[model samples]
Target: MYLYPLLIVIAASSYGIVSTIIKLAMQSGFSVSQAVTSQFFFGFCIAICIFIFTNRTKLSFNGVKTLIFAGVFTGLTNIFYGLSLNYLPASLAVVLLFQFTWIGMLISCITKRKFPSRIELISLIILVAGTIPAAGLIHVDLSQLPFQGWLWGLAAALCYSLFLFVNGRATTNMNTSNRLVMVSFFALMMAVFFQSPEVIWNGTLFSEGLWIYGLALGLFGLIIPVYLFTIAVPKVGLSMSSILGATELPIAVMVSVILLNENITSLQMGGIVIIILGMSLPTILNRNMLSITKKSTTLGTK
Candidate 1:
């Protein structure tokens, strides 16, 4: 039981390390194509191994196809995020990526054809207001920073939300390991299609330091998080899982500051706090609502 919470923290920390690790790989002369491709390729292999070990039933082609559909968005999410980190400081880049929470809510609103609740509307307003300082746009010189980074960061957020939505709606009959293997397979395919065709043609998939970078990314970015979440979420429930997952933002920011030596302002730190508060509101609200409903039901029964 205690192990589950530890796993959650480990998963969150692993996510936090990804941006810094990518920067390190790039500093070692890795191209975006190489970095993204190797990460997904090695990740795919790891997923396949897990599936082989755990899968007992015959494979379901329908489930595999559904996961593959979701995999395209996941692939785009990673590619865009990697590009964003290349152009922006990891501190600022992570804040941009964290915008996915509100963006995902907006997507949910649009898809359901319903307006956001008052709480959600307020959260959105706070999120937008928070983004300015969080992005360091208010204090930093905007022109000096890469505009493309901002674009890619927001694009990554959109794709991340879309991936979640798609993945959630995908068939659930398949076991988790099998689903992961299928999704990883297609994510690797999309990585190759979108970024590294030339590298594939050049037959340089095994370049120096490729596996080292790939192993770090695969283990941290995909394997660890997925495996830990599978174990932790059912035990802790979504609310606690999400609150614990919030650790990712602070860890990512601190890692960047420590390893990359990026300077962040006080105003930006305040904005990050505000954004996290806004992002967490929905989960906290849901948990409270559930508690109130349970109490009311118990009283009625009495």
Candidate 2:
């Protein structure tokens, strides 16, 4: 039980650190395409290595196509997000990316043909309200923010939500490592398509220690989290997984503040707290419902 929760934390923490690392890599002269492509490439390599090392017996091809399709979203999510950072501040970009939380809930509700629960509705309200400040848009001048940046951020959120929805339904019982290899392979292919050939062949990505940054990004941003979440999500369930996943936002903000010298005001901090509260609400409600069910059963038995 604790192990599942711990895996969620590790996955979320790895994801949280990725944006800041990408920012750092950019500051060190890595282009957005270079950063995105290299990360996926390395992620594919690492996943392949792990798949071979652990599951050398035989490979299962079940649900390979669905996993590959999910990989397309995975690739797009990284591309949109990494490019969004080019025109947006890292802090605000991460907050925008966090919109996936509510978006994911909406996707679930629609797919299941059910309205959101009272707790979910309340959570969405709080999430939207908190996003204004958490994104530092409350007092900041709007004219300064690029329209393209916002578009890219929202696109990233949409694709990410779709990815989660698809991933939840795809290849549930397949070998985790093999599934990751296929997913990573397709993700890498998509990254290559979006990436300029000159950047790959011209040795541009090989300079300025970009490979090292790419290795780190691949490990944290793609490889580790996907592996852990693949294992944890089935056990803990999506609502709990999402609540735990909210750990990414604060961890991202903290990393930006500490490593990138980004600043957040008291008001923004308040908003961040609210966002965290919204994310946790669903999981808390789920737990209470379960407890009540158990209690009712016990009482009936008496």
Candidate 3:
């Protein structure tokens, strides 16, 4: 149990860091499609190598249906997210993507006919309030932001939320490594359709020194963290995993501040706190509810 949460935190932190590096890579001359394709390709290679080294056997392709589903959604999520970065700043793009929390909750309500708990409701409100500062919405000039960027960011959030929802259902029985490999393979196929082989083969697609960044991006950004999340989700369950995964936002802010020398205002810091509080509310309330239920059961027994 502890291991699962720990892994999730680590993976989330890595993802936050990777987003910044990817943004940097894009500024260094890589197109959105090129960056997405390169990361998936290298990530696939790394995952395959890990599979081979660990199992000492041919990779398993047992869960074809689930793999295909996961792969398609994952590919779509990355493509849209990469494209979103072209229109939005790294921090803003990430904040928008985090809207998946609300989207996921709405999905649960619609699909399961369940009302959110009181704590969840409060958390959701706080989370939305927090976004104002986290997104610099109050300070930034909305007129300066492109409408297309906002569309792409929202689209990315929806796609990512769907990816999480789909993967939650798909990986019921599959091992982590197998699921990752299949997803990467299919994502590679999808990316290839959009990427020009001429550019990639001629080595004209990436900026100088991008090979190193791309390799790191693949291994740290995609392969290891994704594999860890796949394994962690099964152990801790989706809701808890998602809640804990909120760590990525603050981690991203901190990473940007440190690595890119970006300044975060006091209002932005307040927003971060609110977001964290919102994310933690569900888990905290669930635990308290369980405890109370257990206490009542004990009293009734007595």
Candidate 4:
């Protein structure tokens, strides 16, 4: 029962480091277009390889169209996220992107025409509260930051939320590899249509061997998360999955600390603890629900 939620957590944790890697690529003089395109280009390459070896059920025409459409959200989210990294600090940018936690629940309520359950409401509030300090935003002066960063970051959040919503609802019965290749192919196309700069077409990637970054990005950022989420999201409903995805931010913080050797404030550590607690709410509730159901089943049989 908890397996799907655990998959979401694993996928999110792996994806959390993508921003740090993208930032490293940018600081190495790769353009956003180069980084985004290279990431998705290689992602599609991997997807195709997986699709070839994996057994896939024949898909309907409408399913193909829907997966293609869903791919756009994935592409836009990554592209805009790369753009955001250009202006904001990675921590701040991630915090902004995580605004999707609330945005996702709101989208669910609006589309389903029903309010979120009490546990979801409580988790949402806790996650938001924890998110602020986890990014160390309490120490930064937000007023000094450029408006464009906020705009792009929030836009990424919207796209990311939509991507999650779409993944949870669309053609889940299809084979995992089939959905991955279709979504990844269209996402690569979308990235290219965003108009990659000269770097993508030039020797910058091949000569300098920045293709290594693309390899890592493709494997870690796209391939792992996309494959896992495709399997997980349909099993776990949107609200629970959204909450589970909050693990990314804390995991990102830990990655920055370990890999980037960045300093973490005391407040940020506290926030990480709070975020973990917030993430645990659904799991606790689920366990209780399972126990209750088991008890009731025993009573009925008696």
Candidate 5:
């Protein structure tokens, strides 16, 4: 049980590091399409290798239909996300996407007919309040930021949230590794269609050490973290996993500060604290309320 939480933390941290590296890769002249497609391609290869080494018979195509559907959303999410990176700062884009938490909750309410408890409502409020600081919206000059970038970022967030929900539903009976491998296969197919074959064959794709960089990007950013996430999700449960995954936001900020020398204003630091506070609300409040209700029931019995 504890192992799942720890794995989630590791996955989140890995994602944070990858976010910064991807930004650097973009700065190194990789196009958004090239970078994203290459990552998926190599990620597919790595998944294949892992599937082969771990156990050949465990891989199954039974879930291919669901995996392909989920992969379409996943591919689109990453493509738009990469495009947003071209226009927005890594930290800003990440904060915007983290809005998925609320989106997911709302979706749950609609689909599950399960309204959030008072504690969950409080958590939602804290999450929104925390974003003001996390996004540096208080200090940043919006006039300079492109509207297109913001649109792409929001689109990416919505798509990513959908991907998460779909993937969660699809992997119900599938092994984590098997599901991941199928997801990668479908993602690779989607990427191939979107990427230019001529450029790939002409070796333009591999120029500027993309061969090496692409492999590393796939392994660290796509393969390992995703595998870890799949394994962690069932163990910790979706709500806890999502909350713990929010760690990626701060990790991204710190990675940008350290690796990219991105500036972190005092307000931005405060925002981080606010986000953390917001994330804790659901866990803390819900647990306490549950305890209180249990105690009240015992007293009523007397």
Candidate 6:
């Protein structure tokens, strides 16, 4: 029970670190195209390798198509998120993206045509409350930013939620590598549509040595999260997976402060604590009962 949720946390942590990686790549004179598209390009290449080795179960044409379509949710999430940053401050954009935590819960409700449990509801509120400060948007002047930025930001949020929802159900029992390969290929196609493939065709990958960042981003950003979520979300439920996914923001803030030497206010630190608490809320009570049951079993065996 605990193992699956922890996998989602690990996946979310992988996501949190990508921002720091992107910043480091950009500072090293990499273009946005190189910094961003390398993730998909190398990710697709690596997934192909994995699929070659682990090609046991073959997917039907419909299943392959399903994953390809599902892949668009993540691709659009990144595209919209990038667009939002053009017109809004990074802080504002992140806060808006954080809306996915609740939006995911809303999606869970709509799909199941039911309400979330009491604990899940409370946890959702706490997570949303934490997000405003955790993203450092406590004092945003949204009145000045262009309206299109907000639209894009919210669109990113929705797409991210949908990404989790769709991927959770898309051919879960099929070949893991098959699903991974299909998703990565389409996502790479989407990236190429919006950005240039000059990183490959122009020989920038070797000449500028962008492979280092691309390799890291490929593993951390694309492969790890998608693989883990595909395995865990179906078992843990989308609402809980989304809650665990909120850990990304707090970890991103920590990485920014510790690795990037970015300063965080005391309020932001407090919000980080709140976000962690909220993330743990749904699991903590059940885990305590699990502990007691284990102890009782131990006594019975003795």
lDDT of 5 by residue, 1-302 (tens): 35777787787667666667777777787776777777787888888888878765666778577788767776776777777888987767887677766776666577677786676677667767767676566766768988888988888777766665665564555677787788787777777887533445678667656666567768766776678866776565555556666766877787788978888888878878877787666666666888999999999999
Candidate 5 deviant stretches above 4 angstroms: 1-6, 170-173, 196-200, 205-207, 234-241, 286-302
lDDT of 4 by residue, 1-302 (tens): 77888899999998898988887787788777788888887898998888878754554345776787678988989988988988999999999889888998899899989999998899889999999889988856789889999999999999988888888865836788888888888898888788473555787767987787888888877888889988898888777888999999999999989878899989999999999999999789878999999999999999
Better of 3 and 6 by TM-score: 6
lDDT for model 2 comes to: 0.79
Query: Which regions in candidate 2 have their CA more than 4 angstroms from the true location?
Result: 1-6, 197-201, 234-244
Clashes of each: 0, 0, 0, 0, 0, 0
C-alpha TM-scores of all predictions: 0.79, 0.90, 0.88, 0.94, 0.86, 0.89
Error of 6 at 251 (Å): 1.0
Among all windows of ten consecutive residues in candidate 2, which has the lowest summed lDDT?
237-246
Q: Give the distance in Å from residue 236's predicted Cα in candidate 2 to where it truly belongs.
A: 5.2
Maximum-TM-score candidate:
4
86-160 per-residue lDDT for model 1 (tens digits): 898776677777776567666766777776677666666766676677656674565788899999999987876
Give a tens-digit lDDT track for model 3, residues 127-174. Answer: 777777875667666688778877877786776566555566645455
The digit string of per-residue lDDT tens for model 2 on 1-302 reads 36886788788788889898888888887788888888887898899899889986566778887888778988998899988999998777887788787787777777777776787678778777777776576766768889999999889888877776666664845788988887788888998788743565677667657788788889998898888877787676554565567667877877788988888788879988987887677767777898999999999999
Instruction: Assess candidate 5 and give its TM-score to the true structure.
Output: 0.86
Give Cα distance to truth, residue 269, candidate 6, Å. Answer: 1.1
Q: lDDT of each model, Cα atoms only? A: 0.72, 0.79, 0.72, 0.86, 0.72, 0.82
| Candidate 2 Cα deviation (angstroms), residue 64 | 1.6
By TM-score, the better pick of 3 and 5 is 3
Off by over 4 Å in 6: 56-62, 140-142, 170-173, 288-302
Deviation from native of the Cα of residue 94 in model 2, angstroms: 1.7
Residue 287, candidate 2: alpha-carbon lDDT: 77
Report the C-alpha displacement of residue 240, candidate 3, in angstroms. Answer: 4.3
Q: Superposing all C-alpha atoms, what RMSD in Å does each candidate have to the true structure? A: 4.2, 2.3, 2.6, 1.9, 3.0, 3.2
* Tens digits of lDDT, candidate 6, 1-302: 68999999998888777767766777788865666688888889999889878786554345776787667886777677767766776666777877889999999999999999888888888988888787777776668889999999899889889989988884735767777888888888888888657787888886788888888888988899988888898888898898999898888788777877888998898898999999999899778878999999999999
TM-score result, candidate 3 = 0.88
